[model samples]
Target: PNSSKVQAYVLSRKMLDKIVLLASRAQLPLEAIIPEDDVWGDTAGELGNFLLLQRSARGHFRISAFVEHTIAFHRSIRSVTPPLTGVPSSELQMDSLSLELQRSIDYLSAQLRQVQLHQLKVCCDEE
Candidate 1:
C-alpha cells in the first residue's frame, strides 16, 4: 500500500556542490535550497496543478508526478520530447520516453490501488 511506499529523492553530489559554490560566490546565506519541483507541487492548489517541463530542440527531460497533491515521483533523463526530426537518436528517445511514462503510471496505479489519476498536468518551461 501507499504507507509502505515512501517518497524518496536522491540529489546528485555535483549538483549540490555547484549550488553551494554559487551561494558562496554570491555571498548569500543559504539556509535551504528547495527543489523547484517541490515548490510547484506545494503551490499547485493555487495554480490548479502546474508542472514545469524544460523543452528544447535537443535537450533532456525532467519530469515529476504528484500524488495527493504532492510530488510522489521525480526523474531526469537524457532524452524526452526530442524535436520532430526523423533522426535515429531522437526516435529512440521518443520510444524510451513513452515507455518510462507508461511504466510510472502503471506503478502509481498499483501502489495507490484506489485513487485514479485523471490527468498529468505539465507545462513547458520557457526559461
Candidate 2:
C-alpha cells in the first residue's frame, strides 16, 4: 500500500525533521522555524514523481524523484566516464547548495505565517 499520498506524507515529515535539525543548529525552536499552516502535495507521473510543499503565501519547495520508466533506458545506455586525475575541487558547491536549500526552507516557513495571517484577515472580514 505504498501509495503516492502516503509517500508524500512521509516526505513531508522527513523535511520537517530536517528543518528541526537546521533550527537546532541555529539555536532556534522548531516551532519558530516552521510555519503552522504549511501544506504538502504530491503528483506522480510516468516521467517522475514530484513533491510540492508550500505555504499559502509566496513560498514553496519542490523535490522530485525520477520515475524508472523515464530514466531506466537512458541510464542503461549511458557509459560511465572516468574522473580526470587532479586535486578534487573544493567542497564549495556542496556547501552552497546546502545553504540555498536552508534559505528556501526558512522562506517557506515565513510564508506559512503569512498564510495564517491571511486566513485570519478573511475570517475577520466575514464578520
Candidate 3:
C-alpha cells in the first residue's frame, strides 16, 4: 500500500527555467533544482537540530529548518539585521533582530505543523 503511493513535489515552471539557464551557464548537466531548504535539512542530520539563515543581496532574509537531515520547512522575510552605519553598537538593531527572529520562528512553526520536526542548532551565512 505504501509503495503504491506516489510522492510529488510542487514547483514553478519559471524557477525550473532559471535552473536550466544557470546550469547552462556553468556548463553543468541539468538534473534537478532541489530547494536550498532540502540541503540544509540534510546537513542537520539525525537529531533534527539544524537551522540556516541566508541574506539576500537586496537586504532580505531567508530561513530553513531541518529534522533528521530532512527538510521541515523554510521562509523568506524582510531584513532582520540592519545595515552598519559605522556605529560601534546600536540597541535598536539588536532589538529589531530579536523581534524578527522570533517572528520568523513563529512562521516556521506554523508551516511545520503538517509534519514533525525539532531541535535548535542554527547556521547563518555571513555577508
Clash totals in order: 0, 0, 0
Where model 2 places Cα greater than 4 Å from the true spot, the runs are: 1-89, 113-127
Error of 2 at 28 (Å): 54
- Models 1 onward score TM values of 0.53, 0.24, 0.54
Over the stretch 1-127, how does candidate 2's per-residue lDDT look in tens digits? 1123322213377887888888889998655432222211112333232222222222222221122212110011012111211446346633543464455445534533332111101101111
Better of 1 and 3 by lDDT: 1
lDDT by residue for model 3 (53-94), tens: 555455566666655575555566564553423556577765
How high a TM-score does candidate 2 get? 0.24
* CA error at residue 35 for candidate 2, angstroms: 28
Backbone clashes in model 3: 0
List the candidate 1 regions with Cα displacement exceeding 4 Å.
1-32, 46-59, 79-81, 84-92
Output the lDDT of residue 65, model 2: 18
Query: Candidate 2 at residue 81, lDDT?
Result: 17
TM-score of 1: 0.53
Q: Report, for every candidate in turn, its global Cα lDDT versus the true structure.
A: 0.62, 0.30, 0.60
